[model samples]
Target: MAERKSALKRAPARPELNEKLEKAKKQVITEEQLQEQRASFVYGNAPKGSRITKESAIKATKHIRVVTPAAA
Candidate 1:
């Protein structure tokens, strides 16, 4: 015959863990933070003392000139 299983017990909580949880719960994100995260995800890492934002966007030239050899 098999024996019955007992209920699992919980470990005592630490004050440091509680503090960290409280800090995380109270943390808030700002618009700039969202922008930085988005930039990092799309463009990889940033440089020291400076970060790339959406303001510096790259655009392709719309005008192109094509010339054919002088009536060869």
Candidate 2:
């Protein structure tokens, strides 16, 4: 009987790997840029038992800034 084939897998192509690395590098975000992005979540109609807190609201929006409406 002939020798059995190896089950090892080949690594990703060099060019493709380099392109992926480059894309990842470009995806890096700076603190200043992060501070510039902001999202606002206001109290809105929801199920009667639903609730939202300041910290939770901020975290739900990810690292971006969270703004809230000024008291009327």
Candidate 3:
């Protein structure tokens, strides 16, 4: 007796895969352009506390600095 091939077995079509690959290739953009676009969104919208006064900056740095002990 000869073995028979299954009729349900099939291979994927090439055109669908090619179309997906072409779409993926066109979606890429550079990081520099992305950053430039993001910068435009916040061009004039500064946060309330974003303005750093000299006194406040000095105080913040003083509080955040770590002191080291002398080695014997």
Candidate 4:
């Protein structure tokens, strides 16, 4: 029986991509920017007293059969 060996090849390193990655690593987020982002997520532009309640959810889904995995 004869034996053979296989070799793997790799791509050359990119200095431009390394420089971009280093720039991205040095990027920082300020506290004000973080607070603004969190506020935008937590508080929407909806009018007051327009939130959905449990009664509203029940009423909306009264005629629908929302089947669960457990029921199936």
Candidate lDDT scores, in order, read 0.57, 0.59, 0.61, 0.61
Q: Order the candidates by TM-score, highest first — what do you get?
A: 1, 4, 2, 3
User: TM-score of every model?
Assistant: 0.34, 0.26, 0.25, 0.29
User: How many clashes would you count in candidate 2?
Assistant: 0
Clashing pairs counted in every model: 0, 0, 0, 0
Deviation in Å, model 1, residue 32 alpha carbon: 0.6
List, residue by residue over 1-72, the lDDT tens digit for candidate 1: 999776676768799999999999998988567556655554444454565544441111112235787975
Q: Which tens-of-lDDT digit does each residue in 1-72 have in candidate 4? A: 777655565657999999999998998988566555544543454355877554444444444455667764
lDDT of 4 at 70: 75
Worst 10 residues of 3 by lDDT: 56-65
Model 2 stretches with alpha carbons more than 4 Å out? 1-7, 32-72
In model 1, where do residues sit more than 4 Å from their true spots? 1-12, 44-72
**Alpha-carbon RMSD, candidate 3:** 16.7
TM-score of 3: 0.25
Stretches of candidate 3 off by over 4 Å are 1-25, 44-72
In model 4, the number of clashes is 0
